[model samples]
Target: MSLSAAVRLRPGPVDLTSVETDAAPGFEGRKADGEAALAAMGAELAELQERLFAEGQSGGRRSVLLVLQGMDTSGKGGTLRHTVGLVDPQGVRITSFKAPTEEERAHDFLWRIERALPLPGILGVFDRSHYEDVLIARVRSLAPPEEIERRYTAINELEQRLVDGGTTVVKCMLHISAAEQKERLLARLDDPTKYWKFNPGDIDERTQWPRYREAYEVALERTHTEAAPWHVVPADKKWFRNLAIGTLLLEALRGLDPQWPAPDFDIDEQRGRLLDEAPIA
Candidate 1:
């Protein structure tokens, strides 16, 4: 089945243009049956990733860029920890971008991200990427309105250029509701061991959920394009979110059809001789 058919994504009522400010229904925690579906999807994704890795080795060309952007506690780390665990690490790389360091801040925003792009025959995953410039900057009023708008346009063009240069871009926005986020935050606060996960600043951000929603809507609508479309995965149910993301990633990699490079010299005769002499040990 097509990825869309498998997930059965319902269109949000707010038009794409209005996604930033729109509060769509987030996926409730999965039902019991969702667990089985998630397992099946995980297996399928593993198989697909293996095939893509083999093809990537053969083709000796082509790479994939998977950009995962989400609000805090949207399961970005969990999804990466699980989904990527199924792939051959030698063929994949994950980069987590935090608040820029002094050196990173010295360069253009894309510079840090650009440096992390995948080489040929590999998959690169970006956790909280250049999109933060739009999402967080807008939320905190860090940049002027004119600058924010310009960055959005620049991001689209940059992604377009990457696609034109042979990097298939698969971007995902993990979607969760305010209530679910609250539950997660509270869970962290109530558990002594989980205290490290809670940030005092998170409380401040929670107050601005509505504004962040607006920021995301605008970001998604403006950034969504034919070359690099965004998949807004339902993240309230961690299992379903992972399943959907893994399914989408597997499909994208499968579509690439990477193949191993051809041998430079004939090996048939040498292989026959080696087989005949193999018992000489």
Candidate 2:
């Protein structure tokens, strides 16, 4: 299965309960092979990123935006470290959205997101994004039901504007099972090194798992679009998750097919001038 077919959420009604969180659909490789495959993709991703950067330097208006959303322990950070980490830092812009501060809360929800958008010829990654308003806000009752419903339309419009402005948005939900989440959380609590990742609030959120699932289902169904579709990545297997997302990203960049911009000045003349200049000691 292609990564696109394996995990990209379809339009219309979506039932989160039916999707397998642990399925590694497209990959039949062993663990070591999977790791090696991911490594090879890293090189490809680097080359494509360089082309994208060059295109931007030459005034190209294309860019990519990767939006990641999932429950805690779904490996959003891991995806960044292992998958997106392949790209040049100078060519990528990463943002992690947290709770709205006093100032942020004063404006519309998308105000902060608008400010963080990647420039042309860049790859932008959002650890959590505008969907938070629908997912967390709906589940936690942070906003009214009527307002939450409105945000669904609001998000679509915002993403459409991004697409219109030459941004190709790729959204992924790192789907993981409740059992896997329990094991991961326990491992975190048991390991001294991972204490910082263990949060009491996570437990609080876990208790509302069903509600959050419903929220996710609604958000995916409402917001998944041709312009900015969502991919439901099975993330219980960390290696597979990394491989799958890496593949998706590679596909997106390949689709763009950015080429290295040609030099506007005469290359031969420049080379001759360089050679004729005084040699360094």
Candidate 3:
């Protein structure tokens, strides 16, 4: 099965509590094996991404948007550092959404999101995406209940539009158990070098874990559409998380079957022109 299918959340009422955070759903590899596999995939991933970028330059409209949502210290940064880090930086666009600025707050929740979407042929990654309106907003009562309900439908519609316009949306939720999250948070506190990553607000958010889980479940169920489904990666194992997401990216790119664009000019003419002119003083 494709990695997307392996980690995809089935259609039904969602229950995150039942999922295992440490289980490597479809992979049978240990840490070393997973790392080795990712390394092997790097060359192919880079080549495929280059093809996609070239196609975009040649007028292809298709692109990809990877939306990664998770709780604090769920390894969003680490995943990008490892998996996405392997691909050529030129073909990738990454956006990390923080709290809304005043200008962002003035517009619809998706307004800022739309501004960051990938253009044709680029592989775009969202560290925390438009889901925040429904996830954090719902969990913290940041929006009216009625407004929250409306945003879900709006998100589904926007994603469908993106698909119609040739953008593939790959949504993932990095799931780590509460115990695992606590441990990660404590490790950050313990490591002075990671002090900057330590946030007192994250501990405050921990107080509402149950609420957040429910919010995520509802968001996953309501917005998980046929065009853009959600994949739940058990992220306690950092190595496996990287492997699964890396595979997801690989599957997405391969599905597009991006090929090198045909040279607009005659290849023979261009080759002769370049070869004959190369010895200029």
Candidate 4:
């Protein structure tokens, strides 16, 4: 099966434990080979993005939203830098959600999210998205059980509106094992450059790994719908993760198949005018 299909989380009950976090299911050969493939895919994605932007310039209504969710050290940042970073920055809107501010807490949980939705013809990325309301809220008891359930329905409805508004949503959960997370965190601690990336709170969060896993399972099952599907990307291997995301993005763009907008002015007339203009020395 294709990497996109292999990593996709289908509708129904999803057991996080059943999924492999370390395996590269749809890729072959060495890490270098995967990186090479990813680079090629990145080029294609850039071209597709240019076309998508141009289509929007010509009054096209479509856009793309890529939502990345994962545990700490699951390589969410790396995916953004290595994969999605290939596209033109002007056409990419990236929002990284941190703790909610006082004003954000005063509003609905999705209010900040709605404000960050990608504009028409741009590719928007959510480093951490609305799923946090269900994940952290459930794991940390930030909201009541009944309220958590309601958020699922609210998320579905919100995504439906986004789809109706010409935005295609692609959500991905980067899955990494506890052992792998430990290694990455330790490496960060040892490397002075990465020391800034470490957080004492991450250690505390790791203690509730089981609860977080269950929260993700519930969120994935509840929100995986026809309008917006979820992809559980294996992220222990960075190369494969990049390749997988690039492939999924490429496919989404391919499906959209955006074209260059038709020229408003007469092509022959413009060509003649250009020819008649003074030649450069």
Highest lDDT model number: 3
| Whole-model lDDT, model 4 | 0.92
- CA lDDT of 188 in candidate 2? 100
Give each model a TM-score: 0.84, 0.97, 0.97, 0.96
Task: Single out the weakest 10-residue window by summed lDDT for candidate 1.
Answer: 16-25
- Between the candidate structures 1 and 2, which one is better when assessed by TM-score? 2
Clashes of each: 13, 0, 0, 0
lDDT (tens digit, per residue) of candidate 2 on 142-186: 989999989999999999999999988999999999899999999
**What is the C-alpha local distance difference test score of each model?**
0.76, 0.92, 0.94, 0.92
Deviation in Å, model 4, residue 263 alpha carbon: 0.9
lDDT string for model 4 (1-281, tens) is 87788998867889989889887877776799989998877778999999999988889999999999999999889999999989999899999999899999899999999999998899999999999999999999998999999999999999999999998899999999999999999999899999999999999999999999999999999999999999999899999888888888899999999988889999999999999999889
Better of 3 and 4 by TM-score: 3
lDDT of 3 by residue, 240-278 (tens): 899999999998999999999988899899889998886
Candidate 2 achieves a global lDDT of 0.92
What are the per-model C-alpha RMSD values against the true structure? Answer: 4.0, 1.3, 1.3, 1.8
